[model samples]
Target: MATHSSEINGPDVNDPAINGPAINGPAIEVDRLTVRRGGRTVLDGIGFSCPPGSITGLLGPSGSGKTTLIRALVGVQIITDGTVTMLGMPAGSAALRSRVGYVTQSPSVYSDLSVAENVRYFAAVFGLGTAEADRAIDDVGLSTAARQVTGSLSGGQRSRVSLACALVARPEVLILDEPTVGQDPLLREDLWDRFHTEAAGGTTVIVSSHVMDEANRCDRLLLLREGTIIADGTPADILSRAGTDSMDEAFLSLIRHSMAGGRSTDEVTS
Candidate 1:
């Protein structure tokens, strides 16, 4: 949303700004990813790829491994087997230090610092300056609270601070986990708008949400259920394949099919 010519770069081959074209490939790729925690399977073998300029929504109910899957993509979660690659490099590689931006469910800003200060800190990590931080704050509609102490802000405001921090870096891949949990509908819409802007700029965006309605905003959807991916496709594809107009119904239908021990013909991919 905050377009900085030099800083907000993408992996597009047609982009005239960058010297060499980015390698033509999916922004993210996973193959048979599996994770086990405390001897319990948290994520079954899963594989998928997220192309640049696309918004991939991770949809599922609580304990559906959405958060766990996100953690794996961001390189924070340990996997039992399989591989996750981001921007052509392995997930969590030091080479990906500034190329990937991740915002967790919990706000990761400093409560003792002001909103502007918090964003400036993260911007500095990416070798950015004050102007970039302010633009990111404005992108999230938090310019008015720039000088306010982060601890004094409301839950929703604090969440925006976290989002701003992530946006400040203008990463090639933006991963958000339940970013709109504390935000209002209007703020949610604004945030999703910003997400679209990022995706349109060739940033691979991965947004995790429990709300099925948000799936419509994504170009592709990954519906996870009980440590497995039940569906993978566009909103319409998922609905059409499930033979239902309602996303909830589609999810239920897919889940039932999975429980019946049959792989979704065009649903889950692994």
Candidate 2:
């Protein structure tokens, strides 16, 4: 992780384009977000912002509310307190629905369908046309596999297909939960390159992942522990705060500090 105290800019935290959100606009903003499962609190006062044109990775251990947070962002989970705003509107709302694209942990595509068929299905579901859907498939380097049976594809290949399906609608906010889970390191690297390319092209991307190295590739990160934000900032900011050279070391140091004190990082955002 890298650290810099200077304020970072892009879209607000929720917008997919975190680097240059709507030419001086916040893409996503959350304030005092909290979520509970049944009666158990899963997230407590969680808050973070992502501007457009940048990539923000949601990192944490298993059951740390990473999925819960992503679900809240994409409208699958409701906030018990606080608010989640995307593109200046509430997430999961009808207005944000057209502008927000999401790929869940499961491949949401039909295994029996062809790659192109899956893209077309999503296009129809998203109200996008063939031309745009085709372009999106090409964007993710899945053009060659368009005619193949999706179930026959390899894991990495399926991941790419899922990504392409998500992009078919050209949504401003793209939320991905464990997008690269099954991919090997090499393919994962390639996916990150594609992610960067998408971000540079002005897409706001929020991804959830347990892969530390993949998290390092993000422009900014929100680290979660026990369903709460333990650290939030650019990688460098976290690294500096942890007083370590590598992000892994920084994360370990921060975890140790938290265990010693029985607390998350002291920093809290409104």
Candidate 3:
């Protein structure tokens, strides 16, 4: 069995001090979250909180439950136990339908439609106007290709279209799963910049990726292995605690320590 460490600054959803005033509580909170698929536990007692206006990176290899966790947060996955609250309401509530934006790993767009058309469609679905949809298309650097047919665009361009649709709603919480998978280095950098811009504007951005290099771009990181979070904290904090200079090294150090049956580096440091 894999052991997990408690979050250092766990937010209290009920306490006004944590949830009141300036709204000091987290934008998303998961408590003892567990998920099962096909009779096997995919996520085991996971817990964490993503603060408002922050960029949280979920880092884990394939089948590490990164996708599953993201689905749970978006209120799509059925969990066997635990709870997920987003913006003070239960995950997947009807009210959250417009306040939360989700972009899956695979691009979900109409191949026959123009890039701009796709964004416009989703924007309307979210009750947003045409201007919002146009801005979102530009935000993803797809303005020049907005009139191009989605099927004629490259894989990277198609992916950006999906991202634009998600951004069109301008949701308070944005969840992206492997969004940069097929993007070029320049496109990836631009997308990261956009993510930070959104966070600066008070949007909580939770992104999931298997790439360790992207960890440094996040305000905080949650490192998972086999559904268990082994490290959770700022990138610099994780490196300092793990005695590593890089995110990859930090992950390896934590993995080695866990394999040795020792306390998680995060726990020891906390």
Best by TM-score: 1
Off by over 4 Å in 1: 1-20, 263-270
C-alpha positional error of residue 55 in candidate 3 after TM-score superposition, expressed in Å? 0.7
Expressed as tens digits, the lDDT of each residue in 1-270 for candidate 3 is: 112221333433233454234444789999999998998889999999887878999997788899999999999999899999999999999999998999999998999999989999999898888899999999999889999999999998999999999999888899999999989999999999999888766788999998889999998888887888878888888889888798888888887776677634445232
Q: Give TM-scores for every candidate, taking all chains together and pairing residue i with residue i.
A: 0.90, 0.87, 0.89
Q: Per-residue lDDT tens digits of candidate 2, residues 50-124?
A: 877779998888988888898899877977999998887788888777788888887878889999998988898
Q: Rank the candidates by lDDT, best first.
A: 1, 3, 2
* RMSD of each candidate relative to the true structure: 5.1, 4.9, 7.2
Candidate 3's C-alpha runs over 4 A off are 1-24, 263-270
What is the C-alpha RMSD, rounded to one decimal, of candidate 3?
A: 7.2
| Model 1 quality (TM-score) | 0.90
As a whole number from 0 to 100, the lDDT of residue 113 in candidate 3 is: 100
Clashes of each: 0, 33, 0
Report residue 92 deviation for candidate 1 (angstroms). 0.6
Clashing pairs in 1: none
* Residues forming the 10-long window of minimal summed lDDT in candidate 1: 11-20
